[model samples]
Target chain A: MEIKTLSQDGVTIVTPVGRVDTSTAKAFEDGVMASISACNKIAIRFDEIDYMSSAGLRVVLMAGKKLSAIKGELVLINMPEKIFSVFKTSGFDKIIKICQTFEESKQFFN
Target chain B: MATAANILVLDDDEDTADLFRQKFRHQIMDGIYKFSFVIHPEEALDLLQQQVFDIFISDINVAGTDGISFIAKLRKDYSFMRSIVISAYGDINTLRAVMRGGAHDFVIKPIDFKDFGDTLAKTVRVVEQLRQAEATSRKLSAISDELGVSAQLQRSILPSNSLKKGNIEIWADSIPAAEVGGDFYDFFWLNNAKLGIVMADVSGKNVSAAMFALIAKTLIKSFSQIYTSPARCFETVNRTLYNENATSMFVTAIYGIVDMEKNELTYTNAGHLPIAAIRHNEDPRFLECEAGMALGICEDIVFTDSVHTFSPGEMILLYTDGVPEATDKNGNEYDYERFSEVLRQNAIMSPNLLTRALMESIREFTKGMSQSDDITTLCLKYRLRVTPNVN
Candidate 1:
């Protein structure tokens, strides 16, 4: 897995590529938590991510809970339909914010 | 600062072996780098036989048993040793042979000194990372085993033998999808007049959900002692869960209180699936008890109660979503239609047999496929009263 972070105006955009499974879930969690100390508005770009399992969902749920406690926002953008299905079935779509495009995610800032 | 571990270099060329030793020495003075140069492969084997080493680097074209053979022989006994082969003539076939012979890596002719050093460092780092991961997985497996035992203990907390409290005959079964499930069911007597029935499904699966289910059960039991009304019991549980839950996970539950003498059953549903009530010799119908959201999602949520009269031989069946949502191999759900049919077929059987037949039918429908969610079922059958003569 590859993770890159870009920060602007106190918002951090995290682009993750490749599959996130049990083997790499911890690294993904660490990368997301590292951004938590500095940025309140976080956006995750999952366009390149091909797959995710329950272990991956656990990490995202953990980050969501952390951000919610601080009254911050964690937005997911451009998720692949296959990966998005898992979230929707798990009811995470109701609890977390998801945007169809990066432009739509920027609306939260406005 | 921790010192890098010692590495052993075995090469036929004395000059090349010395260069390899000097390169690692310059990287860290505190770290010890060891070199053993042998003109033939036999001498290298002798050295390896005498002592243990963190790594072994060799030339593929060494005389008297080439590097590929040496690696194959060494791996038979010293399986844990990390081996790397360096070759002046970078033969793709030779590289593949050495790798298949258990060599960790291969360096080509005119080795870029910088790349060689970095590769060596990375090889060690990768090995250490693998070791740590193995250790962690072992710990997690042990903890999971312990949790499985605790889950069995939790199942034992349910009433094993039915309490002949009034005219209600209650039977419940909980089956976890994995080693531990988040589904729970319990029925306990509040007093001579009332009996409380609780069924809950916590979000997520495994240990997190199992822990929350236990806590929810405890809170409901403790609070129901003070307030016997079904609505009040759920209100107290929701408030307590909202304050105590740190993960923000929620639970769907139904709490019912049966007044045996008055033949009244009142219940509050908190985002749980609707319960089914089958009248004596009549078809099953879903109870009209829908009001509240899932618990632990918000504070000050209101839950309304629904009351119904329980006739003799009538039955009420409560279950987690796992039953209705169970899917077959083709992704078709078992659903409420099949569930009610199973109830109607086995409605005449004893409560225990009814639950067993329902589960058997689900198993048959799925064709022995693995259950994806926890399955929980609770049934209450009201019996007719026998007249007594007053002396």
Candidate 2:
């Protein structure tokens, strides 16, 4: 998995390419954790994700928990329909802030 | 000596033995160092082959061999053994040869007993560190071996691959991954008219997932008998799983009951995938229902039950995330498109053949890649629904 991190105006956007399963969840976690360390505001872009196992959701939950502890914000954006379906089925939508775009995340955060 | 490091020293000089023994006599008595001197290179090689020694201290002019070749052979064959070469004149060239030949350190001759002792002690400390690391690796391997044995025993206790009762014919199997996975399934006779079915996957893998799977399977089976509706049964089981979830792990499951008298299959989903249905002469489709939150995530979730008709020869397939999510070498998923294709082509297949076809399809798509998740599937075909008038 290749993770691209771009930070602008105090917000870091993480774009991960390809599957996020057991083999690559650690890399995803590391990228997200790195972003969290540098900035409190983060948005995960799931546009290129092919598939994500429950292990991938575990990482999301972990990121959310870590950010909550710091009184920081973690938002999910641009999830593919299939990926969004996963979060919806898992009821993660109930617990996390999800939006249609990074702009929407900024508006919601503001 | 309990903690003594056995040191093998090679030298032709007969007086070297007595000098080492005399100088380290107090240390030997205190059980810290034990020196074994060999006059010939062959004798040193013989002892090296037979036993594990802590250190090899050799003189460059030892009898029967050139020192560099012998030290190099020891370095190649027993690289972990600490070696120190003796440079007879504090010769820089001899010291360079010793280092190049892979000897760890060198001591000069006319030997400084105190300096020599200090060098040997340093090498001994390195040897002790290696010993501790070896012990830890051994312990870890032993623990993994135990996990392997426990997984085998659990496989023995898994529900049989196939079960038939009344009008329902079921074939269920949970394949074990390289590591122990948390997938489990079962189908049992609840009564003459009711049959219970379960398919579930606990989050993650390893011992905790295995244990959680076992606990959730047992509780679901027990609760199925106590509650008639799948919703009610899952409600109680969900609470138990939530209470028991210290690690915050969750279980995605579908627990259903087939009522032969009513010809209905009613089930409750807990964050599991949708059940696929293959009805004769009708388009294959996933059962329409709420996929719901997984058990142990929240304690207060109110589960809802969904109903599907079990018409004669209707087949239902339930699987874990391993299926469909199985990725190829190019990272493309064997997604629901393939899943439905398999179901459509094998709609008339017996529960057993349908399962084989599905697994073979997945295997074909993921021939060279390794799947980390457990692939579990349960197939049920209602051979004929029970009706008093038909009999």
The RMSD of every model to the true structure, in order and in angstroms, is 17.1, 11.8
Across A1-110, the per-residue lDDT of candidate 2 in tens digits comes to 99999986678899999878777888998998998998888899999888888878878887887888898899999988999888887777877899988988997555
DockQ of each: 0.04, 0.33
True lDDT of residue B315, candidate 1: 81
Q: Write down the worst ten-residue block by lDDT for model 1 chain B.
A: B1-10
The interface root-mean-square deviation of each model, in the order shown, is: 5.8, 1.6
TM-score of model 2 (CA atoms): 0.67
Give the top-scoring candidate (DockQ): 2
- Which sections of candidate 1 miss by over 4 Å? A1-110, B1-152, B161-165, B386-391
**On residues B1-391, what C-alpha lDDT tens digit does candidate 2 reach at each position?**
2578988998889898999999999988888888888998888889988888889988887733477877888888986688988877777876797689789898888899899889988988987888889889999999999989976788754688897777788888676664678888877788998888888887777688788888998899899889998988988999999898876677889988988888899999988888888986677888878766788777878889999887678999989888878878887888899988888899998899989999999999999987667899999998774456853
lDDT of 1 by residue, B134-218 (tens): 7899999999999999767976755563445558787888777877777888888788878888888877776877788888888
Candidate 2 CAPRI classification by DockQ: acceptable
